[model samples]
Target: PADGRPIVELRGAGKSYGNVRALHGVDLQVFPSQVTCVLGDNGAGKSTLIKIISGLHQHSEGEFLVDGRPVRFTTPRQALDRGIATVYQDLATVPLMPVWRNFFLGSEMTRGPWPVRRLDIERMKKTADEELRAMGIILDDLEQPIGTLSGGQRQCVAIARAVYFGARVLILDEPTAALGVKQSGVVLKYIAAARDRGLGVIFITHNPHHAYMVGDHFSVLRLGTLELSAARSEIGLEELTNHMAGGAELAALKHELATVRGVDVEELPEEEDLTAPVPASSEGTS
Candidate 1:
């Protein structure tokens, strides 16, 4: 955690289940005050990589390091103790629980002496509100069921909770996958806010637009191996999308599928063509 050292780094890290290889030769770097976006499609080994980083699974090959020191975590708690936290896509909140309750779910503060410990209701609620507000979140009531809040608000709550718990490195799994455009934008803003607060973030998502908006570095995965790695300045959003889609291979497959199916591969309409009428044959087909 000293100056110029990456907070988390994976060197040729890999995972396997018996003869089934889930990942291979993966290299990832996450530094303080930066967002490292991991882009991959379904079955591209993104899940496996996250598991290794979160200490849910150990790498079968190569090394996993934290703060430039090699470490092999046997459990997620060990990782958490070392200041690495993963916020999974599900958001991990009980729908019926109040927002403040969800925020302090497992790690609630206790009052009074030992053995007779009781939940410090007022303090926990006040701290939760303060933490959320610090992240630019404003809720009408912390006592409302977490399910009553929007998806973006819930995600922000989870993020603020992690940061408040002293997480030096935060790993987010597809944080924007289920939200609408406006809601997704809201979550993205907090992601940038988290980075601004000097936390190293590992953002895992298939959506390039969301990743590009906040990522300072990118690592693209394909079939359990790293295919590309670059800083934000070295790549464009279009190129990132192409890589995730397998670039020319995906294009070739699309053409081949179209040819084999005897369907014309029509070009997508331009932005200016929104008001134009579709051709009679193509109408209602697309």
Candidate 2:
């Protein structure tokens, strides 16, 4: 049961891409001041699920709820209008533009009347700096291009921008996949900060460690189906890891790795390091 009420909820959601069933009968809930993590392997319908929640794609079945009311979003704009903002790993910022410009990219403030509209640079820069600082993002220079920042920094800026724009529910898609340990921690802290501000957050990632650190609720998907769902207290890290990797697919992978290394399964090396590194190709999602 939702102790209070969820800011966002999905009931029996499903999506299909032609002949391929991407997500099937998935139910999810997102509450304020908490992170709801959606974890899955590649092609396990993580992308499809996020798309449906963020209004990038319409579910073929089931209903989406916001603030306890059912709603249908035909486009991402509709979702944003409902105060649901999505920050994909590849955030839509122009790398060459200054951080201030990127922060106000599409929604720039303007002064003067017709035929004399000019950007309110001073106000925009001041607000951008203040907002970023409030979100625990300290930048050396607001004039610097966003590309100059690390992956975590850019992710922070995007999150801050979304919050500043009046987002009530924030959906992040694999935000920390490209960052190092320290950088990932920065993003996780800001995520907590967002939750503290009473915004519901949906954290989409393949990293269980990261999820466990910030998430209050967890949902695991495998082969386009929901494998497990529960509060953090209901499951431990080992159980979560096993659910994610100790499944049939991971058993097959273990057999393959042992065979290739010419070792028996019982003689296998430590399973801790066996977690596969997300390849560079997957970096495109970040």
The local distance difference test score of each candidate is 0.87, 0.87
**Candidate 1: residue pairs that collide:** none
lDDT of 2 by residue, 1-286 (tens): 2468888898998998899888889999888778899999898899998888788899998888988999888899999998899999889999999999999999999899979999999999999999999988889899999999999999999999999999999999999999998899889889988988888999999988788888899999988889999898898766787678745665677778775756567754445544434433222111
Q: Which residue ranges in model 2 land beyond 4 Å of their true spot?
A: 1-3, 253-261, 269-286
TM-score of each: 0.90, 0.89
For candidate 2, give the lDDT: 0.87
lDDT of 1 by residue, 42-85 (tens): 99999999899898999999999998899999999999999999
RMSD of 1: 6.6
